[model samples]
Target: MMDVPSIKDFQWKTLAPLPSRRVYCSLVEAGGQVYAIGGCDDNGVPMDCFEVYSPEANQWNSLPPMPTARAGVAVATLGKRIMVIGGVGANQTPLKIVEMYNIDEGKWKKRNSLREASMGISVTAKDYRIYAAGGMGGDLRPHNYMQHYDMLKDIWVSLATMPTPRYAATSFLRGTKIYVLGGRQSKYAVNAFEVFDIETRSWTKFPNIPSKRAFSSFVCAENNIFSLGGLRQGRLYRQPKFMKNVDVFDIEQGGWMKIERSFFLKKRRADFISGYLKGRIVVAGGLGNQPTVLESAEAFHPGKNKWESLPPMPTPRCACSNIVVKNCLLAVGGVNQGLSDAVEALCVSDS
Candidate 1:
């Protein structure tokens, strides 16, 4: 893979902000258009507001709101339809309701709800099938249930349960296997790394993450899975400690790589935006040890084995709903003193 270019190759564009402030929203790109789905308002009440952004016009348009108001909904795009799954509803309760919005139809359709009401569920879709993994149920417990939605049958079919019961886990689909790693069981972080084979309908446990952290991000870059910065916790420390550690799992080698401290992020952050961009591992915006939210952005060059500083986010904020569309990484509504309507994109130049 080619090494990422310098900061000169990157540019941040401020786009039209959301119609209203929102946090915990879900953003998904379909047919080149970005959709910002349900999230909480400034009052922290769940909302059903739905909006779409057109890159060509650089504007946002309102769409039919979801039937159920929620936040932290798991979303996946299937063709032109966007699936909105379980999340926290009114009174801060977990919901099992599932809804779908068809861009062509311009309306919302109710689908099969989950067997259990839960929040923070992780969802992944491929080959006309949607696989929903771990979630925190209404009883305030994490569930290991694995269910897939069958479009033809219009029902949710239960699959083999994941060995680890945790919420907000990171899942990656490569070929026919879905790699599940690092989630939370209540407030504690889980280091479980597991993969499930679709055809075989079974799971294989892999090596646990070298570091146990809360709010860490896991991204797949080429053949390696990068576990980026997060907050480390222990009784030894007065409070949760922010980490700058980077651990990589080589798929072919079937084990973790010995990365030096120089390969880690320059800033210690958690709950940040991270992805593989143009052969570089990119990270931006999150809560750090600082007194305020982080705006610092950095990219790691695998070839040089060094981290390079990039242009900082114009509106530094945390807990933003983020998605990568084409070559741009969009950071949607997030907290900045209050709920923010900032919609910004970090675009990489082809040159």
Candidate 2:
């Protein structure tokens, strides 16, 4: 049997930060560049701008704005193209539009729309196909439906639905399989975990997470899936509050384990967007209570299983998306006091 390593030896460092602030944006790596798409600002206004980061230059450049301004969207990359999926707009309305951006051609094109409108959806790309998992939809409510998009054919088809409906969950692609972690439903948070088999066209329940959470970051590294810090229910200042805790799941063994370590940032409820770059997990911004937006960033090393602080972003944000392009991590638009058009780039090598 393959050996499982302990999470003690991991090391991490932060690079630079993005220029703009946003939330619920899309992040993807294409043509050796990282792209950040539409999201809402701190005041809850939706944005239409998008940007890209080139690792070779260690800088960010503006791109054509999204045809529609929205947040809580999903993004995936196939070859040199990036796909932006459904999300919520400033009116708090769900969207089903799907758009494609070609890095090589520097252009945007509309593609097949989703069967159902969804926001805060978990999306991943495997074998050139993009899978859209459980999210909020249908009159701006959460749903258990799952959708699949074929980039080669430019088509979308409905698939097996999730056992429990959720939003703000994170999805990761390992081999031919897709794994989804915890998120919130209408009534409460969920510890439920599920996996979708691309070849079987079906869904199966995995072991429940040790803790229930929503808006947390999820990533796969060294054959293991890690669940980062998120809000847990608690009473705060004579009111309910969200707790911050980190956990992990061993996909090969099918079990969950919590990481007992102190966080550099304060505990707050916010969506986490992450990417695996250079054998490290890069976590960008998130939202807390009054501030609602965060500017700090961190990295986790699977080899050590620990967190390390990095440079703070110029613009604080939550519900944003990030993806690795070449060696840099690109953070896209998100809410920072208001819907923002800000974008940032970070390089671990600089640290």
Candidate 3:
């Protein structure tokens, strides 16, 4: 018996599409700019295209193509350089190659590769070092091994292994700790949550995510971590169901709290792009019911504990790389029908 709140005023706007269509691209926001890295083309072939977009100039500028053509890459921004790690390669094989692009140099330089080939790696950058974690290897089993890349030493130092093995997990840095949340293990979706403390150099187990789901997008805002919509795997021969369940992990409360059902997302989906904007959790573009791709978008206001509908994206697609810029949520290349060159941003304003 609660009422939903309105967004007040918000809108979706189209930006310069990628020079070419791509999917599974790696996206990140650094210094108020958004970067879209390697992905696959319309033919499902891996691509080497690299590009950057500026919201102020409202144009995309090209960057040197990566040394390797791959998709599903783990990308992180370290200062002025962008690091691209493990991904599926051109020959349809998992790769351990690592490369870094220096914004000043305007070119990419090969770095120390991973010790083992992997895909679906979860990565985060902190204190000028990259922490690379859980992903699927050639054996097809998720690896719990966690490693940190030392930019100065030009090597990867093995750290504490994850308590749970999985791929496609979401990671974010708060203070000196990196929190890794829900992913998939084989056919089952993982709901485990854990954190790694850099100063202590150890892993601590947190409460297992109550909702058994994977590929759910999570973001940090207002000192609370929010895990949004994803898919729950079902019985054999049955389709995996999309979920609108929203769980807020209050760092202060030290436990997970479920938001009201009325505050759930407007649509059920997984593998969608999400970001925190102006105190709202914004989710857009992903897989939904009837074997369909969704363009529908929505947001949740934690203060009001209410849901607001957002203007749908121009192209409905899954696996789109996403990041939050200064005042906008940018959704980069993803697949809709086929590969999409579309680049769009969900705009937020104080007015």
Candidate 4:
């Protein structure tokens, strides 16, 4: 029999931060550029601004702001265009408005609104379609809504609703299957995981996470799913309350395992951004219960099951979104004190 090596064998490096600070925003890659869109500030003020980062230049440039400012929106890319979906605004109102940005034209256009307003949802694009799932709606209630947007038709249609209603969950696609993991219900954090088969138009439950959690970030890399840091029960802002544990699930095996290596992040995170890069899972800024926001970054190598530190973002934030474009990771607006205008970049090394 062969033996597996420990996670400590991997290496990592830090990169420059974004130009501004933001939280709860959406990020997507289009036309080889990373776009960061709407999110809130530390004070919970929502924003409408957007920005883009070019890995070749290692710089950020401003873009047309969203027609309506919002936080917790979901952003996905369809060819050279980007779609921004449901979220909440400064008034704490849920929104159903959907917008699209044309990278070549540098203009924004309105699209069909979502069936319902929601915030703290996750979105992914696959096979010319965008899937949005599980978020809180108006009245601050979580919903099980599962919807899809067709890029070619610029329309939306509802699919099967999630079995469990949740908020602040993460969603991604692996092959033809879409998966949603970890978030909060009305009562407590949930570790529930579900998968949707686009071809069959059905939903199925997978093995639940070992621990219940919310505001955690998830990424799919090399056919594996990784769930990272978020808050656990305890006094607000207290130390040892944040979780550094990393959980991995194998879609082929239908099994889950916890990575023994420690993330070594300074704090536990919630409402952070994460994405797959260069065969690794990269995580960015988020907030802790001290209720403090963080700017640090980390990379996890699934093959090694270990975490390595990366360059900290210029602006510390929480509730933000991250996207990969041409080997670069773009972090968009998130909460700092109020809704932020920050846009940062992480240049993934070729090595």
Candidate 5:
């Protein structure tokens, strides 16, 4: 392991805040602008607040809200169109409503909805098609789903179901395959690691994640998948604890890295914002072992196999909707004390 940097590695910058506070909102980048979709308000009620931030002007302008109000929705950007998939609605129940916002047209249009209503769906856009995987349904059970939106027909076609049913899983589209990692079945975390080949239209079961923890982050860096810190479930003899354990899955080798060769994060975190940045695995604010939310940040330098300290977040919060745009990682609305309107970005510093 390399020594901790004496100088700062990453820097934080405060950006123009959102129009209003939001939690569980879907943040996506399209046409070089970041769009914030539906999310819950202070009372935990879903809102149909649609807004976009123009980096050029550093201003946020409101767009027409969605026809339905919902939160925890899966959003994908295709050219000028943004597809908002299944999510929790006003009644605090899962919904099948599917809507697309055409930026060029500046209007929301209804699309063929999902066959089953669910939330926490993992969605990705490739070519012109959208692939939506596992999600939790109204019954609160995770579904072994695998479906793709048929853009030409304006309909959803079911494909091979995943071997392990889960919700809120992280997915990465590599070449023609979609690698889906851990998600939750209910309150319990699912360790299933599976992949779907677009060409073959089938699912292949890979090795399950070595560590089974809730609220863990599964991120893709170069050719490897890293499962970072989370809340480790305890047995009857012990209490639940936060974790800093890190596990790496080597794609070329088709297996996990040796446990002895794996490393650990600098801090134990859960429900944090993480992303692959400038050849490093970066993690920001989240709930740690303490009662208060954490503001610390760190980055794992793969070449050195070491985690170096970085700048802390301007507004410390958890469960923030995060996305990597250009060279910056934007952490949008989250629960800071209460609902927070803070919009901050972790940037690559020249110094």
Candidate 6:
């Protein structure tokens, strides 16, 4: 087991705020840079704006805007370039336009688009290819389409369709498999767990998540997938509910086990950023406790099997895009009372 650090080991700091106040944007890491792609501006209009953050200089530089103005864009880092895929466009329509930005050239290039306009799509890059899976389409239906864009061919090829159609689902690449976890079919949530084998181009259904979530976050830490806080409906038109459930999925074992409540989050927060920092699983900034966007943050040490209170964020926001860079967990633009341009990071030392 790794030595657990005291709460003092974690430090939260604010970086240069994003130039455009937006939410549902695509934020990703590539070539030692963090790129903020298209998302909706404060007025709820889709934006074509794009920018990047350089930790070395503590500054942000504007890249050329994407060709299509859209929000909720799904983005993936492909080597030095970025693939900007389907998203919600202006007029609240799902977009099928796909574009790529060459960081070195500072220009956008077109790629073969998806057959259907998709929103809430989750995309990830591995082995020089991009995998796009479950999302809501313009038809307002959850799509099970699983496709991959082969860089060499500049084409999108369909793979085995997901058995469960859902949107707002998240996929995490583990070895040759991609695990697609909990998402929503509509107002109702789905707890389905499925994995796509990249080598065989097939799908495998695993144990469903103990708690169904749509906008929730499940982060990887300690060689396990920790399904964190989420929001769901209550019975009989009751108010929506927030969850503090801590479900642990052992990657090697292939099953989920709900942990004790003592280890649950300090607050019931959903749509937050959770990631492994050093050896601790750090969660920060999301919607919690009515009328209060959360700034409070906490860390869970696997070795101790307990939670540790940490410093809160400088700003309160939810749906903030996150990507790990070096030893920092970067929280990008999200909604805070309105659209937010705030950018912050939680840094943990090697000690």
Candidate 2 lDDT score at position 55: 65
Q: Residue 98 lDDT in model 1?
A: 94
Model 5: runs farther than 4 Å from truth? 1-9, 259-262
Off by over 4 Å in 2: 1-21, 41-43, 234-239, 242-244, 258-320, 330-346
Off by over 4 Å in 1: 1-3, 234-238
lDDT of every model, 2 decimals = 0.91, 0.69, 0.85, 0.73, 0.90, 0.85
Identify the runs in model 6 with alpha carbons over 4 angstroms from their true place.
none
169-199, model 3: which lDDT tens digit per residue? 8887888989999888876788899999999
Worst 10 residues of 4 by lDDT: 1-10
Estimate candidate 2's alpha-carbon lDDT, on a 0 to 1 scale. 0.69
Model 6 has an lDDT value of 0.85
TM per prediction: 0.98, 0.78, 0.94, 0.80, 0.96, 0.96
Instruction: Tell me which of candidates 2 and 6 scores higher on TM-score.
Output: 6
Q: Between 2 and 6, whose lDDT is larger? A: 6
Residue 144 lDDT in candidate 3: 97
Error of 3 at 75 (Å): 1.2
Clashing pairs in 5: none
Task: Quote model 3's TM-score.
Answer: 0.94
TM-score of 6: 0.96
Which residue runs does candidate 3 get wrong by more than 4 Å? 1-6, 237-239
Task: Give the worst 10-residue stretch by lDDT in candidate 1.
Answer: 232-241
Worst 10 residues of 6 by lDDT: 213-222
Name the best candidate (by TM-score).
Answer: 1
Candidate 1's TM-score reads 0.98
